[model samples]
Target: MAKPASIPGLNPEILAWARRRAGHDVATVAKRLRKSPEDVRAWEAGDASPTYVQLEKLAYEIYKRPLALFFFPEPPEEEDPEHRFRTLPAFELARLAPDTRLKIRDACAKQIALHELTGGRNPAERLVFRDLASTPDSDPAGVAEKLRDYLGVSVEEQRSWRSAAAALARWRESIEEHGVFVFKSSFKQQEISGFCLYGEEFPIIYLNNSVAKTRQIFTLFHELAHLLLRLDGITKRDDSYIGHLRGEEREVEVFCNAFAGAFLVPQGVVRELAGRGAPADDEIKTFATQLKVSREVILRRLLDRGVVSRQHYEQKAAEWTDDYFERRRKSGGGNYYNTQGVYLGKRFLALGFQQLYRGVISRAELADVLGVKATSLDGLEQRMLAGTG
Candidate 1:
């Protein structure tokens, strides 16, 4: 066999930096690259270097970084994304899955690119809730009211949507109308519900599509609370960690949770429902159905208002949680284009398509941004356009 040619002047530190940045250990990288662990260690330790083809595979395929980075004299000083956002602690944020981190980084890059493409122009009209005067000590119900008004989506309007999916679409559109871009992706991890990337020009919210639509609705508002507060970071709303958080971190979570619940199921509506007497499981379901929220949300509200006992609330919550996951598992898969539409979001796709049409970005670049193949661009564009109609 012919020997592969080597690339001179490759920095071993850069190779190590890329691997660490992708959250991959030497063993994992070796497995992915079909190389021995010793070989991977040798390459990183400057004892041996990869050939050009191996370097390309390592850069683009394995680490998902630019090939040019390998030539840098030293590892670039990359900012900790969590530090730029006050929503979560650095340690907690670092615990996210590698794919989740990459998705976030990609989303942030797209946002920055969009901002630059548009010449840094701000949205013509500002979101009313963008300047909300609520604090951690502020009334959650009042804050919810303000957000509802800003969104201009009434409970009657929401109920009239007739289905959870429809209601989610309506709410997402309304929020996007106010200049925020919402995207969905399957985190493939249960702990992370959703996250937001706060930006002055174009803020972004990401929902985990693997969850139930009702749960996604709650996540939408939860992330809205983050954007409204101008905080950015990933959110893992797993109950196990809630009790461990303290101070501002805990307060932020509590406030966002309360605001999301209150925004979806208004306090007055909960009070009125409870006035009829303690709600049964069916009644809770009915309330959730009417409000277009998850039963878990309504049950929490009931527990807070003394309408349901702690034991009853916990039992119902556990049952609903289990049922939700089972349904998710049994629902099987959906159409690829449809799922991609939901994942990329109409607003973000529209922006990308517009850029393509204006010759600001090439079709190849558009495909890259949309995370689809160049050949798939035509159909994706058609689906996106048809969706807008």
Candidate 2:
């Protein structure tokens, strides 16, 4: 009989650290590794170790860390991502899905790559909108007008768009043109709408693609509010947490929400359609169609201006919310390459490929930066060049 394989010794602290940093519990790690929770606990407790083959999988696949890190005398200190970006409380942030955590880390790495590729130059130097700053106390309507001019997304231009999806694409492209990297992901959790990472060189805004296109449009502006405020943070549209906030926290949330509404459904346009009376369902739908915003957005704006009663607004908002999610559930995901283009913003991929083509980075390096296999680069390049992805 062959002798039993020897397990490699690893620092137990590093084992524990990697799991925690990945936001995984023992059970989760065990399930991914096809082991029992007790086995994972034993590894972390220094009572047992994974074999050489198992260690490689744990480091590369499970923990997504370097194998050398496991030999450290102590787990190296990792910067709390929550500190760099204003997010929920630490406990709440830790509860974020592992996939979300991984995506955040991947985005951070990609931002670093962009910064290096640009020779540490500030890409926002030429972006007029990056300098457009505002405070929570600023007038939402005024700020919205400035942003519209900066983005060149006038109501007239928006009216010419073929559909809401087209408007969304145009808006995203406009923002990316201004030097912000806008990407989308199908987050499993419904609570998280989007997040922004503030940077002088490559600020990033990530939108949840699983939601309705209209909601994603709203979130796009909401994150833009964060970028304008220079407030890097994660955003969730869940109404349950509203009552829990107070003072500045509450003010920031309210300001961003109001800014998104004003930006999408300009007050002037709202007044033009709404006049002095409560708007009917048909009127709300008409405004929503013309503005390319959700009916809930129009209703909320009317509610704020006393054009709609609170009771009526609440009923309409709830109904619209339910219908939106139901429709999203029934809709089929479209083309894969197109979805990939949305996932990895066109501008981002363009920059990565430019670097690759210029020999500034190797194909392997580009794959690492873009988070794809090196073999997949050729296909991705073909799709991107054809404007299919």
Candidate 3:
């Protein structure tokens, strides 16, 4: 029997570019493709070529790039991974997990889709990012207060939500209403709490849906703070990256965290709650529940007020994180369509579906842009109508 034929005259440079762009070295790609590293290098060096089947797997499976990308005369331009995340430490940026890298690519694609969907204009009456800018010297709480007032969701209104899940939903809508599109994905790397890509009109906050509801809410504001400052950022489970920064960069990192904490549990309220003395953990926990925020936020505020020692606050924060994860482990997975709808959110889904209904985009295009399979489109739309945030 004749062996499968290789594609003649394939551009080895493009194959090499795709692998590097995907953050995989030759050995990693070769291992995943079940090819010898020498053979893979030969293909990349133009001494050999991959068969159509091999190329297909390389395009869709290994590199997570389009098959057409390999045929381009030159690799397309994209935001530099390090440059896009200017606030991320060099150490963290250099060692970004492969899956996290892909998530960043996924985020860039969504930004491109938004441009195509909206005809290069934001639909919101006031685009928040376009209107807001911050300096390193900006007061974190002051900016957060301005943002909260602009969002128009009063603290009294926040307390009325009564549950973090409900608050997250409302906060997502409030942000979306102000023109910042929020997206969620179950990150392949759970240590990534959230990240945002800043654009003048279409700044996006992508949260890890696997995170707890309260933490997600905190992250929503944290990422928003980055957008307000007009910089892209990533939030991890540990913020040790902050320690790696210096000067204005360090200030910006500190500002983002302080901004989020202050935004979620405003200074005045926390101060009042803490009163004349150090509040007990039980009291802090009660305030957190009432505000639909994480205990860490309440504790951090107390620390800022000098009512709680740093050592005590850190110990409690660590314990709460462990408890949260244990509870999450016991909770298990949720319904797929519902999760997807919530991830994409109704604001984004409406844009795609409206475009499809108007014949502006084909069903396939809608599914492609939404990152849902065409066959699953109906189910996703149904969940969108059922109103998952």
Candidate 4:
């Protein structure tokens, strides 16, 4: 049998660079590529090379990098996750699951797509992140009220929505109307509820579609607050790290939590619902579901109002946080195209198709923008028109 031909002109430094960037060592790459460790070492040392097929697998499968990166003179400069999420501790950033990293990476690619699709300017008339900029130390309640007013969504209108799903759809549309592009994906790391990447013109929130709609709604606001503060953030199931943050970082995370709660269920409304005293567990659970408010937010509100003790709140919240997550996993299954629509989002899909129709982009480019196979575009558009996506 002939030995596979090695592809020449590929930079060995970039091969090593990509591997290190992806947090893998020589042995790991060798194992994944089914090659001896010495072979992997030789490839990175410029003494040997990988075949085109080997390079393709290494670029796409092992490192999750673009194929062209291997041909570059040197590795491109990308922001370190630690620096991007300034508030998160080094330990916290290190704990990010591999899938979580990929989702975040994909989210960045979507931002580039947005910039290219809209000619470097946001299509929205007003960009909320730029307009609503605030300090981490700013009054979260005031900021929440201002954001809610800017969104033009009121408590009465919020309650008027027939169901949580309807409210989510409306809130998502309203948010997109303001400039932030919201996208959804199934996060293999259930601990990650959602995250947001702040940008000048294309700030975005990426949510975990596997979570309950209530948690998703809360996460949207939590991440929105981060963007409003000109910061990138992650909302996780295990949020105990908030306590570990110090000074400005602590304030930022705390503000995100406060803003989401205040925006979703205002204090006055919660007080009114509680009436004479603290709400019962059932009432908290019921109202949380009906209004698409999170149980954690409700309990936190009660804790703030001197209704529930901090101890009670903490214990109860810890107990209930994982319930919906597991239930969501068990119940997950749906039509593929409809699911794709929901994941890519309506506004994004419409914009991509509009570009394709105008001849601004080709079918292959449209597929990358939508993150769908070119052949799958027809089925996705069908669902979008039927109002299911």
User: What would the TM-scores of all predictions be?
Assistant: 0.90, 0.89, 0.94, 0.91
Q: Which 10 consecutive residues of model 2 have the lowest summed lDDT?
A: 121-130
Per-prediction tally of clashes:
0, 0, 0, 0
Q: After superposition, how far is residue 104 of candidate 4 from its true place, in Å?
A: 1.8
State which candidate, 2 or 4, has the greater TM-score.
4
The lDDT per prediction is 0.79, 0.79, 0.86, 0.86
In model 4, which runs have C-alpha deviations exceeding 4 angstroms?
Answer: 1-6, 25-28, 35-42, 273-278
What are the per-residue Cα lDDT tens digits for candidate 4 across 282-378? 8887878666777878888878778889889888877887676566657748889988998999999888988999999999999988887899999
Error of 1 at 275 (Å): 3.4
lDDT of 3: 0.86
Residue 145's C-alpha lDDT in candidate 3?
A: 85
What is the alpha-carbon lDDT of model 2 when measured against the actual structure? 0.79
List, residue by residue over 1-389, the lDDT tens digit for candidate 3: 96556676567899998888777888998898798999999899887788898999999998888887888888888876788887788888877767778888989999999999989888889878766678768999898888878888788999999689999999999889989999998877777898999887688999998888998998998888888888898888777678888887888888988999988888778768878588777888888998999998898888877888989988988899889889888886888888888888898898989899899999999999999899999998888777755
Give one digit per residue, the lDDT tens place, for model 2 in 1-389.
Answer: 85435455578889998988887889988888898999889888988777777788889998888899999899886665567654355555656777777767777776788787778764543563366778889888789889888877788888787778888888898887777878888887776878888776677888888877788898988888877877776777554454566687667778888989998988788788678487678987887888788888888888788877878887877788788889778877776666776788777788889998899999999888877888878877887898753
Per-candidate RMSD, Å: 2.6, 2.7, 2.0, 2.4
**What is candidate 1's local distance difference test score?**
0.79
Candidate 4 achieves a global lDDT of 0.86
What lDDT score goes with residue 32 in model 3?
85
